[model samples]
Target chain A: SQTIHQWPATLVQPVGSPLSLECTVEGTSNPNLYWYRQAAGRGLQLLFYSVGIGQISSEVPQNLSASRPQDRQFILSSKKLLLSDSGFYLCAWRAAASYEQYFGPGTRLTVT
Target chain B: AQSVAQPEDQVNVAEGNPLTVKCTYSVSGNPYLFWYVQYPNRGLQFLLKYITGDNLVKGSYGFEAEFNKSQTSFHLKKPSALVSDSALYFCAVRDIRGAGAGKSTFGDGTTLTVKP
Candidate 1:
């Protein structure tokens, strides 16, 4: 069984503050990772995805970035957070052979 | 561009009644469709998928979906609705032969409310 763990379940910060959300998959290696943001009562928006380490693909232009430093580790970072960046952030992993994606618990961010 | 459309913003059904959440997709190549459920403030859970073969696929939580090639629709259906079945449902579509995979286009999720 595979499990994805996301840290800092809830965070509140002021404008221009740094942001870091970490995600790690315990039971899988070399899995495709993705980052998505969902506004309150809205649909999901794809932010970034990585196929391998040091490789990140940005789906939409925003104040966010993603990095896969290790086989099972994925990190979402931002130099400075914006008010619009506040939302529910999710980290997901997809196996090489399967199209189904498994998502983590998600981090609730609030920018004050 | 591959895309998915969930026409209804919400669907209301009474417990013990049949329920149907509609989903339609558009893609250039072969379509890979999926249905997901999301509880309040939680991550999306995969319910069912239609990759190939049988048009009817069964999945978790007593949910099933039927794929119609001519209609270009993959609708989620259940014979009986439960009060616990209330949640947000999303429809997703992917083109198997497209430029890049690991990316699926999703529709604006439909809120399914099962009343007791």
Candidate 2:
């Protein structure tokens, strides 16, 4: 069975501080990875997706960026955090031949 | 561009009564539709999907959705509503492979409340 892991399940960052959220999939290779944000009581908004190492496609322009450094490792980063960046960040992965996606536990980011 | 719409902001249903959450989509060529559920402060859980084959797709937790090609709707249905069933439901659509990179467009989501 495949399992997705995200670190710092909850994060509190000061305004203008750097941000980093890490995700790793245990049992899949060459899977497509995605980054999503959800505002309070709102639906998910796609931020970025990566098809392979060093390949990333951004959906909406924002303060955040994503990278696929390794086949099973994806990282979401920002040089400086903004107040508007406070939300729940999710990392999901889907197999190449499958349309279904599996989401991670998620990280609750509160930028103060 | 591919998109999805969940018309209802919220749906309230009494326990033991059937419930339906409506979802519609617009996409070129064949579309791959999916339903996901999110509990409070939790990540989205996969409910069901309509990639191909049958129009009626059964998923986790006794939930099912019917795909109506003419109407362009995939409405989720349940035989009976349970208090635990109260959550946020999201509908997503993506164009078939070779069209795009398999990125899904999501709806605004509908909150379902099952009253006891």
Highest-DockQ candidate: 2
* Candidate 2, RMSD to the unseen true structure: 1.1
Native contacts retained per candidate?
A: 0.66, 0.78
Show the colliding residue pairs in model 2.
none
lDDT of 1 by residue, B1-116 (tens): 88889999999999999999999998888889999999988889999999999999999989999999999999999999999999999999888986645589889999999999
Q: Residue B106 of candidate 2: its Cα lDDT?
A: 86
State the lDDT at B113 in candidate 1.
100
- lDDT per residue as tens, model 2, A10-36: 999999999999999988889999999
Model 1 bad stretches (over 4 Å): none
Worst 10 residues of 2 chain A by lDDT: A39-48
**TM-scores, chain B, all models:** 0.97, 0.96
TM-score of chain A of 1: 0.97
Q: Chain A TM-scores, all candidates? A: 0.97, 0.98
